[model samples]
Target: MSENWRLDPDRALPADAEIRKQARAIYDEIASLPLVSMHGHVDVDLFAANKPFRNPADLLIVPDHYLVRMLVSQGYTPAELGVPFTDNGGTVAGAEASDVETDSRVIWRRFCENWRLFRGTPTRYWLEHEFAEVFGLSAPPSAENADDLYDELTAALARPEFRPLALLDSMNVEILATTDSALAELDSHAELARTLGPDRIVPTFRPDSLLHVRHQSWAKEIAQLAEVSGIATDDYAGYIRALEQRRRAFVAAGARATDHGHVSADTTPLARTEAERIYTAALRGEATAAEADAFSAHMLFEMARMSTDDGLVMQLHPGVLRNHNARIHEKYGADKGFDIPTRVEFTRSLQPMLEEFGLSHDFRCIVFTTDETVYSRELAPLAGAYPSLRLGAPWWFLDSPEQMRRFRESAIETAGFYNTSGFVDDTRAFASIPARHDLARRIDAGYLGKLVAEGRLGPDEACETAIDLTYNLPRHAYARHERNA
Candidate 1:
C-alpha cells in the first residue's frame, strides 16, 4: 500500500478476488520474459557515449512525450517540462525553466509533488513499474522521498552496469532493432557490433526523411543522400538510384527493413515519363504543392518496387496529420505529440500499389495506421487478400492496454492472428521498452483468458496463442521479410 495504488492486476482485469489472482499469474509469467524490441528510436548516441544519466527527471520525465503531454494536459507547458525549443530550423535549444535551481533533485521534487496528477493514467503504471522494479524503489515517489529516490537512481546510474549498453544486457534483450535513416552512416551500430558482437543492436532503415515532401530541408536532404551513397542526384532517375544506393548501404550496415511514413496511404505507380517530369520539377524546386504530393504517392510505389527487388521488409506507417499544432511546431519541432490522427481510406489510396505488387509472394510489407476505423474497413481485409501485406501492430497513439485489446478484437476476426505482425514497442524511449512490452503481453494474456473462459478457445490453444503473441510470431514476421541482417 505504501508503493502505489493497486490497479487491476495485469493492467485492466476486473478486480475480483479470483480474476485478479488469475491475471497476476499471467502477468508475472509474461513480465519476466526477455524483451524483443524490433522497432524503437532510442538514441544510439547514448549507448555510444555510455555515460551515466544526468539525473532522475532528465531520465524519466524530460524526453518522454507521454509524460510531457500528460503534464501539458494539466497546464504544464512543454517549455515548463524542460522541452527544448526550435525556431523554424527544426533545431531545439534553450531550457524552459529559467534561473531556478536546475539540479536533478529539484526537478524530481517537482514531479514528486505533482505525482497525484498521474494517478489513474497508464503513465503512472509505467512509471511505478520502472521505479519499483528497475531501480529498486519500494516507496512511492512523493516530495518526501523525491531526493532519496533521485540519489539512489543517480548512484545506480554511475555504476558500470547502469550504462546504456550494460543496461540492455541486464534486461536480456535478445534482439533490438533501432530505427535509423536510410542515409545514415550507421558507424555507431557498426562500432557497437565490433565491440559487443553482432545482432545485438541492429539498424532499421527509416526513409521518411527522404520521402517527406513537406520537409523544409528536402532538397538539401536529397543532396546529402547522394553524397553519402555516391550516387548522382541531378534528376528523378538519379534520386531513385541514390535511394537504392543508400538502401544497400543500410543493408550492409545490418538493416533488413525499410520504413516509410506518409501523410496518407495514397500510392501511385505512374509511367516512367511522368515520374521523371515530377522529379524534374522537384529538382528545380518548381513543383506546386499538389505535384509534390502526387510525387510522394508515386515514390511510395517506387519504394515498393525497390523492396521487391532488394527483399527488404517494407513497413508503411501512414495517415498521421503531423504537427497539428502550428504554434508547437514553431516552438518544439516535430514528434512532440503534436501529431493528430486523420481520416484515411486505404482501399482506394493503396489500390495502385496493391494491384501491382500486393499478390507477390516474394514481397513483404507491414502496414500501420492511426486510423482504427480502417482496421475492419480496409487494413484487415487488405491483409487477408494480399500475400505481400501484413498488418502492423497498433501504433503511436494506440499503444495501450485498451487499444491493444481493441486491436485484437477488431483485427483478429478478419485478418486472423497469423496475418498480422506481432507487437513492436515502436517507442523512442529506451527505458519504456520492457514496460510497454509487459503491458502488451499482459493485455494479450488477459484477452486470451477471456476467450478460454468463454469456450472460444481451449486453455491449451490459448496458451499457444499467448506464447506466439509474446515471442515466436515476431521472429517469424521478421524472418518472413528476410530480416536476417
Candidate 2:
C-alpha cells in the first residue's frame, strides 16, 4: 500500500500540549456540519439536466481552474490539462488524444505520475479528501494502484449516489447558490427550485455587464436587458429602468443579492447631468475612456440605491487585474486563473456609495478584497461603522487556511464576527465545497481556541461562537433579511 499522507488534527496545533488538545476538540465539534455554499460557479445545468457525469476526468479535472492552473504553472499546457481548447471543447479536447492510450490504466498512470506536484497545497488536501470520503480510496494513488483506482472510481461514479443532486445530499449541503449573469434566463435555477424547492437551490444576481463599458457585448447586453424589462436601452432613464426590470426578474428567480465584480471599488455617484451625458456617449459606443469609467462608477451608486429600495443585498469584490495576459486571454479566454491581485483603496473608492447607502438599515453590502492589506486598514473599520456594510470572507487568491486565520484575527478585532459575512465556498468545483468549508471551520476553531486559552472568551462562549461561525452566520448573512426584516 502506498502510505497515506493525510493531515491529522494535531498538524496545525500549537507547541503547548494542553492547548493543542483543546483546539483539536473544538475543531472536531463543528467540522462535520453541513456545508453552506453561498457563492460559487457550479453550472446549474448539472442539476437541471439531471444527467450522470460521464467520467472521472470530466468530473475531477476539467471544470476546476485550480487543478488546471496548477498543472499549467508546472509547464503542462492547458490543453493537456483537459481545459477546453475552444470554450466548449476546452474540457474534452485533450481527453480525446488522451483516450488514444485507450486504457483507463494509462490515464491513471499519467495522473499518478503528476501527483507529487500537488503536495502540501489546499488542492491536494481537497482532492485527497474527496478520493477517500467519496470514492472509498484509502491506498494513496500511485503507479501500482492507478488502474485499479481508476476502474473503482469509474464504477463508483456510475452509481446513483454520485449524481450531482445526490452528491449535494451526501455532502449535507443545506443550500447551494449558483452565480448567474443578469442576462441569463435562470431556467436551470428555476427547474432546481421547483424540483428541490426554492429554499435548497437559489440564484445569486451577478450583473457584471452593467459595470463593463469596454466589453464587446456591452451594447447587446443593454439591449437584452431592455428586452427582458420591456423598455428601451437608448437613454439614461431607460437604462435604469431596464436594470431595475432585470433585478426584479432575478429576485423572482430566487436571488437574494447582487454581485458586482468591478476592477476597483470606486463608487462615484455622479450627478444626473453628468450621468446622462456619459450614458449618451456610451450608447453611441463613442465614450472617452474617462467617460466610460464615470458611467460605471455612477451605476455602482445607482445599484446601491436600487438595493435599498428592492431589498437585494449588494456584494462588491474588487481589485482583480483581470485579463492580465493578453495572448493567453485571446487563446483561452477569461477566468483561466490568470487574474492577479492589485492594490485596492476602499476608504476613498467606496466613500461615494457608502455616504449614500452605508447608514441605511435597508441596505446590506458585503465587500470582498484580494488586497489583504485593506482588511484591517479599511474594510474592518468601514464595516464597523456602517450599518449596511459587512466584510465578505477571505476570497479567491486569499482563501488559504493561513489567510483565513489572518482575516479573522485582523478583521474580528475591529469589525467583530457579526460585521463580517460568514464563509462562502466561492468555487467552480462543486465537489470541493465541503472540503473548503471543512478547512475554514478547522481554521476558525483553531483561532477561537487561542482566544479561549488566552482567557479572552469563556469556553461556553467559544463553543457557541464555533457553531455560529460554522453554520448560523452563513444562513444569516445570505438570508433575505432586508425583505423579511
lDDT for 345 (candidate 2): 89
For model 1, what is the alpha-carbon lDDT of residue 448? 72
Lowest lDDT block of 10, candidate 1: 92-101
Candidate 2 TM-score to native: 0.93
Q: Which regions of candidate 1 deviate over 4 angstroms?
A: 1-10, 14-29, 87-102, 480-485
Per the 3 Å backbone cut-off, how many clashing residue pairs does candidate 2 have? 4
Q: Write the per-residue lDDT of candidate 2 for residues 1-485, one digit (tens) a residue.
A: 54443546555445566666667778877878888888888888888986787777777776778887787787866655555443444234233433223333444566667888888777876787778766676576777777777777788888999899999999999888888888888888878888898878788888887666667688888888887778998898888888888888888887888888888788988889988888888788888888877777788888999998888889899899887877567556677778888998899989989888888888889899999999999999999999899899998888887788899889999999888888888888887888778777777878888888888988788888888888888777778765633
Clashes of each: 0, 4
